[model samples]
Structure formats: structure tokens, C-alpha cells
Target: MPKFLIVGATKFEIQPLLTYFKIPVHSPEGLFSTESGPDISALITGVGMVNTAFALGRYSHNLFDYIINAGVCGAINKDLKIGEIVNVTNDTLSEMGAEDDSEFIKYPDLNLPGTNYYENQVQIISSALNGLRKVSGITVNTVHGNEQSIAKVRRLYEADVETMEGAAFFRGCSRLSENYFQLRAVSNYVEKRDKSKWQMPLAIENLNSFLISLIEELEK
Candidate 1:
């Protein structure tokens, strides 16, 4: 059986999938794996870029065939429905570059050799879950709730979703494994800071359900 690593920002986001897989809690602070079959494992990499990079770097000695970064994200594109699961084929480190006066300067603007973005060819095309849109995402240290900032980022990237740890996850996995995927569920629209409009529960439900099915397919 092929080994797989499932990563999430918080325990709450991946709790359902862990429970379904019956992966017992081993360490309170680090990685854990299932007792039987397939070498399926889970890691909760706190939140944001620094924590995610550190977590993956610390425990990435073992090799895995596939790494799945799963979480809830804020949807920038209005066409994406709340609670819809999406495959993030590409992700950018949106706030990695410097800000010159009122203008935001990206890595490319600085003549950097490497890119601030990462792309993967692995896709979610299982028959069990159909019509899950594949989209581009931007990972930011701070999620945009202000209209001005959101507008600026949307214009720059033309991305569909935004998450705190997507880019770091992609970077870590791409360096450590050949097959990597970023799967996200739309929890809220990128509007003003409105908790009332966010469908977190629905998003978590759909995300975990899809993850469970995807794991089954991969194991077979």
C-alpha cells in the first residue's frame, strides 16, 4: 500500500476525517498514523505560513507517495458555492514580496530567481465525487477581509480561493514528495468580516466526506 500524508491547519478542520479513519491520538503536538493498513497519516500544522513550514520540515524525513493538504478556505470567486470542495491545482504566496509605498511589489518585481507560486498536476477526478471544480488559490499570511486589500489581491492573482497555509503546504510537499494535492472547501465568501455568512460546519462536513472517499479510492 502507498503511504499518504493528510495535512490540515487545525485539529478541528481534520477531526472528522481522522475519526473516520480511526487514527488514534498518539502525540498531542505532532504527527500521528493509523494502526493498520495503507500507512495513512495526519498532521496538524497550526496556522499560517511559518507554522506550516516548520511542521512539515520537522517531520518530513519519511517518504510518502502522496500528500493531501485539506482545509476550509474563503472563496474569492462568487461562482464557487459555499460548502463546495475544490482541487487547488496552483497556489501563490500572495504576501511574500515587499510593499513599495502604496504599490505591492512581488518576487518577480524584485528579479528573484524562484517563483512565489507552486503548481501540481495531481487532480481529484474520482468517480465517487464528481464536478468538484479545479481552481487556483492564493495563500496569505493574513486573509483579506478589507475591501481594498481583497480587490488588490484579486486583481493581481485572479485566484478562486484564499487560505492561510496552502502555499506553504504546496512548497513542503513538492519538495518532499512527487504527488501532492491541495483540497479545500469553501467556507465563506471574500467579503467584509462577517462570521454570520460563513458556513464552516457545512464546509467541514463536505470536506471530510470527500476526504474519506478519496482515501478509500487511493488505497484500492
Candidate 2:
């Protein structure tokens, strides 16, 4: 059985997972072992790109067969349903670029400066992931909430979803493990800030449900 690590941005986002596995570490600090399934572990790396990078880097020395990043994301493509889960095939820091007047010079186009575009790395798409919609994503420090910024992003990248730590996780995963996956569930559409319009509860519920099923499958 392959060892796995479920990486999440926040505890609340993966609270159900902790409950399901019956992990004793209530205030999960670091790598905690469990008899839940095929040597599975979890890391609650605060939030955003910086926190994720630091947390993953701190534990990079520990080898894992697979690293799966799970969380809720904003739907950039209106066709995606509110509670639907997706597999991010590619991701990049969309904001990491220099603005030359109206043109934005993306990181990949820049001279030899270690890329933030992290899809070139081969991902292990298991049977559980083949059914999921494989979509491109862009990670950001600040989620798009304003109309102008949202519109700008929509025009700039051909991404289907947006997450806070997907790219950062992918970048670290490039070195940490060969088999990695970034799973994101849509909680809301990228529109003007409207908490009333978001379905966070449903997204979290579905995300956790899938995680449970995934772990169960791993047990086999």
C-alpha cells in the first residue's frame, strides 16, 4: 500500500476528515500516524501560498508516496456547479508577473527564474481521479472579489477554477513526491463578494464525503 498525505489549507476545511479517521491530534501539529488506511497522514497548512510552502517545505524531508491537496475553490467557469469537485491538472501563480503598461509578463515567459507554473510535473491520476473533471487552475494570494479584478483574471488566464494554495502545493510536490493531486470543490462563482450566494457548507460536505470514500478505497 502506498503512503499518502492529505494536505489542506485549514483545519475547518478538513475537520470531517479528522473526525472520520478518528485522528487523536485534535490540534493537529505535524505528521500524525493513523491506522485509518494504507498509511495515511494529514497536514493542515494554515492558508495561502506562503503558509503552504513553509509547512510543506518543513516536512519535505519526510517521504510520502502520494500528496493530495484538498480544499474548496471558486469556480471561474460558470458551467461548473456549486458543490462539484474537480481535479486540477495545471496551476500557476497568476499574479506573479510584471506589468508592462497594459501587458502582463507571466512568470513562465521570464528569464531563468525557477517557474511557478507547476503542471509540467507528471501527476498520478488514479481511478478515483479519472472521473473528475480535469481543469486548469490559477492560485492567488488574494481571491478575486472585486468586479474589475475578477474580469481581469477571467481575461488573462484560461483557468476553470481558482484556489489559494494549489499552485504552491504543486510546486512543492514537484520536489517532495512524484505522485501528487490537487482536488478542489467549487464553493462559489468568482463574482463580486457575496457570501449570501456561496454554498460553502455543501462544498465542504461533498469534499469530505469524497475524501472518506477515497480513503476507504485506499484501504483496499
Clashing residue pairs in all predictions, respectively, total 0, 0
**Candidate 2: worst 10 consecutive residues by lDDT?**
120-129
lDDT of 2 at 216: 69
Backbone clashes in model 2, listed as residue pairs: none
lDDT, each prediction: 0.87, 0.85
Best by lDDT: 1
> Candidate 1 regions off by >4 Å?
26-28, 123-125, 128-131
Write the residue-wise lDDT of candidate 2 on 1-220 in tens digits: 7787899988778778877877655664456657654577888888899999999999998898878899999999999999999989899899997888988888777775687678934544457767788889999999999998988998888999999999999888889888888888899999999999999999999999998887666556
Q: Which candidate is the best by TM-score?
A: 1
* Every model's TM-score: 0.94, 0.92
- Candidate 2, superposed: residue stretches over 4 Å from native: 35-38, 120-125
Worst 10 residues of 1 by lDDT: 122-131
Model 1 C-alpha lDDT per residue in residues 1-220, reported as the tens digit of each score: 9898998888889889888888876554478899986688898888888899999999889798878899999999999999999989899998878888998888888997899988887644567544568899999878898999888997788899999999888888877988788889999999989999999999999999999988888778
